[model samples]
Target: MRTPLPKDKCVAAAPLCQSDGEIAIIAEFLPRRIELTRADPGCISFEVKPTGDPRVWDVCECFQDAGSFELHQGRVASSEWGRATAGITRSYSVAGL
Candidate 1:
């Protein structure tokens, strides 16, 4: 279910959409990356989808809020997960939801 944005103070500083993420990983590392992402609590929903070309895979993640999103970002960047799968194109637009 699509969750409504919380009107509480926790979300006051957060963007309207909270978070939107898109990641493109080299296919070989996708399984590991997906594993890492789905393990994060902040990720309200996570999905790994195929690209037409077998060489690429796309990741979609939606976090509960900005804080959750930030937490996930830091975790991914600092953990073995990030180091293990570092490469290819990662495009994220998180500002203003």
Candidate 2:
């Protein structure tokens, strides 16, 4: 089920599962992505943290609204960070879309 969120607030929270080989790529690229994402005007909050499992990262991001989230998606899709993680597995739960 979708999490409860106001219509004007968008959120994505979940785990990013990485393979042994993908871990290096994520580590190399995620920092810059986090920097850029947090700088976005519509970003409310963003976080990515490593879990007890080395291969999993907990990701939680909130945007001002659906429009903001869509814009973020577009930006990421064309970004180098997006390309690097394109093949990585992600289990995300998003609401307010």
Candidate 3:
């Protein structure tokens, strides 16, 4: 059985991108982004995968806590990936934060 995550100790989100240009941007930057995020000490898990729709991706990530998640956000905000995908639409939700 899996252990339950500590309440308010984890930050999770799901962001979706829909558009050919957005998809291409993801293809270019996501690999490196995933690599960097996964290496972060506060990252519990990070996964971004293409959905059944060719232009859509499923983005799921979990951080050790809200602070970690905010740190990740700040890092991304100044990164190449952030600039490239700035205008793409995303619907995100958070839990345990």
Best by TM-score: 2
The C-alpha RMSD in Å for every predicted model, in order, reads: 9.4, 4.9, 4.3
lDDT of 3 by residue, 11-66 (tens): 43334566677778878888998998888757878877767876666667777766
Q: For model 1, how does the per-residue alpha-carbon lDDT over 1-97 read when each residue is reduced to its tens digit?
A: 3342343312111111111222332434557766877787666566666667444444556666666667878887886656744543444434323
TM-score, one value per model: 0.58, 0.82, 0.79
lDDT value for candidate 2?
Answer: 0.76
Q: Which of the numbered candidates is closest to the native, going by highest lDDT?
A: 2
List, residue by residue over 1-97, the lDDT tens digit for candidate 2. 2243454444654435556778888889989999999987677788887889887877878877667777998998899988988888777688766
lDDT-wise, the better of 2 and 3 is 2
Give per-residue lDDT, candidate 1, residue 58.
49
- C-alpha lDDT of all candidate models, in order: 0.52, 0.76, 0.72
lDDT of 2 at 39: 85
Query: Lowest lDDT 10-mer window, candidate 3?
Result: 1-10
RMSD of 1: 9.4
